[model samples]
Target: MSQPPPAAHHAGHVAVIGRPNVGKSTLVNALVGANVSIVSNRPQTTRHRLLGIASVPGGQLVLVDTPGLHREGGRLASSALNRVLNRAARGALEGVDAAALVVEAGRWDEEDALAYDTLRASGLPVVLVVNQVDRVADKASLLPYLQRINEGREFAALHPVSALKRTGLDALVASLLAQLPEQPPLYGEDEITDRSQRFLAGELVREQLMRQLGAELPYATTVEIESFTEEPSPKAGVMYRIGAVIWVEREGQKAIVIGKGGTRLRDIGKRARERMEQLFDAKVFLQTWVRVREGWSDDESALRSLGYGDS
Candidate 1:
C-alpha cells in the first residue's frame, strides 16, 4: 500500500523585527535563499517593508523584513521619515503568525529594548533570534547571554544563528515552521517577493551608493526610478531600459554623489546596471543622474513621490 506524504500543513507569516544593523534583512534574505532585500551597514537603509516568501516541503513561511527601530534624533530629527519607517516596521507585525526579534549575540541596547517592548505589546508568539553569533569570539559566552535574555520574557523559541554565514538556519526554520499555523502555502513556490524588478533595481543602485559613499552621504541619498520601460531586443526577447535619479538634500551632496568628472556617479550606474542585468536576466540600460531634491527626506510629498509608505 502506498502511504500518503507527511502533512506539510503549517504555513504562516513571520515578522523579523530588530534594532538597526542587527541583521533582520540578512536573515530574511538568507531564509528565502535570494536577494529579496538589499543590505547595507547604514542605519535606515531599508526605508520600506518587504515580504520574502519561502516554500518549505510541507509548509511555507513569509518573512516580513522591516526597518530597524531607533530613537529619533539628528538631521532626521524632523521626524517625518522616522515616523514613516517606524510605521512600516510596526505594520509588518500586524496579523503575523509569529515574530522573530533579532539581536546581536552578546549585546543588548536601548533599541533592542524598544524592539522587545514592541513584540511584547503585540502579544504574539515571538522567537528570539540571536544573529551574528559567528562574530562571538568566545563561543562559550553565548549560553549565559541567551539564558539571561530568555529570562527577560517568554519566547516560543530561542535560536542562535549567523544569518551572514548561513549557519544554524535549518534548525531555526524548523522551529519557526512549528510555530506557524496549520495551513497551505500562501505564495506560489516560484514566487520570491512582492517587490517589482523596477523597485529592486532602484534598491540595488541605492545599495551601491550606500556602500560606496561615506556614512553621512548615504543618509542624504535616495534613489528614484524616474522611468523603467521594456522593449523587445534584437537578440533577446526583452531588455529593460531604466532611467533613475539619485536624490539628495543639498547642492554640496549632489556634487559629492556626482563626483569629479562625473566618475563616481558613472561607477554607481555601471555597478547598478550589472546588478539589474543579473536580476532581470536580460540586458539593462540603466541611465542614472544625481539631482538635488533639497530636504526630500523630511518632506512628506517628496517621500511619497519616491514611493515611501505607499502600496
Candidate 2:
C-alpha cells in the first residue's frame, strides 16, 4: 500500500492588544513580512482591526492589530475609537488559542497594569510580550517587574521582543506555533491579509498625511477613497484615476491643507500619488479635496458610515 499523507496542521488567531504606541502594528508587520498595517510614531495610528496572516511550514497564524484602548470623553471620534477597542476585546479573544499583550519596555504603569488585568479577566491564554526592547537602557531593571507580573498568573509564556529590530521573533513564533491546535489552515496559505486594495490605498494616504502633518492635524484628519478606476494607455502610461476626500474640522485647517496658492495640496497629492502608483504597480492620477466638517467625529451616523459599529 502507498504511504499515507502527513497530517494537516492547525491554524489559530492571535490578538495583539495594548495601549497606543506600543509597537503592535510593527509587530504585526514583522510577523506578516509585509507592510499590511501602516506604522508611525503617533499614537493610535491604527484605527481598525487589521488582519495579517502569517504562514509557516506547519501552520498559519492570523494576527489582529487593534487600536489602542484609552478613556475619551463623549465625542464621535472617541466613540469610534472605543468601538474598535471593544470589537477586539470581545471578538478576537473568544475561542482563540492565545493573545500576546504587547507592552512597552521599562514603561509599566497603572495603565499597563489595567491592560494586564483586563487580559487576565478574559481567561484566554496570555503571553506577556515586552516590545521595544531596544529602547530600554537596562534590561536587567525590567526582569524584576516581569517576574512580578508573572507571579501567580498563568501565562503560556513570556517573551522579550523588539518588533522593530526583529529581535527574538523567531522564538516567539515558535512558542505560538507550539501552542496552536492541530487542524487545517484558517485562511489560504498564500493569503497575507483581508484588507481590500481600496482600503490599503486609503490607509497609505492617511499614513503619509500623518507623517507630513503632525500632532492634532493627524488626529483630526481622515482619508476616504471616493473613486478608483483603471484605464489602459499604450503610449503615455497605464492610468489609475483615484479620488480621495480629506476631512478636517475647521475652514482654517482646510486652508492649511490646501496651502497658499494650492502649494500644500499639490505636495500632498504628489506624495500620495507616488505611493499609490507603487502600491498598485501602475501610474496613478490622484485627485484630493479637503472639506471642513465641524464635529463630524461626534456624528453617530458619520461614524457608522466610516465603518465603526457597536458589537
Deviation of model 2 at 2, angstroms:
10
Which candidate should be chosen as best, given lDDT against the real structure? 1
lDDT value for model 2: 0.78
For candidate 1, write residues 1-102 as lDDT tens digits.
999988757889999999988888889989998988888888777878889998877779999889988877775744688888888888888889899999
- Using TM-score as the measure, the top candidate is 1
Total residue pair clashes for candidate 1: 1
lDDT of each: 0.87, 0.78
For candidate 2, lDDT tens digit of each residue in 175-276? 777777888889888788988877887888788777777663535677888998889967647887889898887888887777789887787788878877
Candidate 2 Cα deviation (angstroms), residue 95: 4.7
Q: Kindly report which residue pairs in candidate 1 clash with one another.
A: 8-58
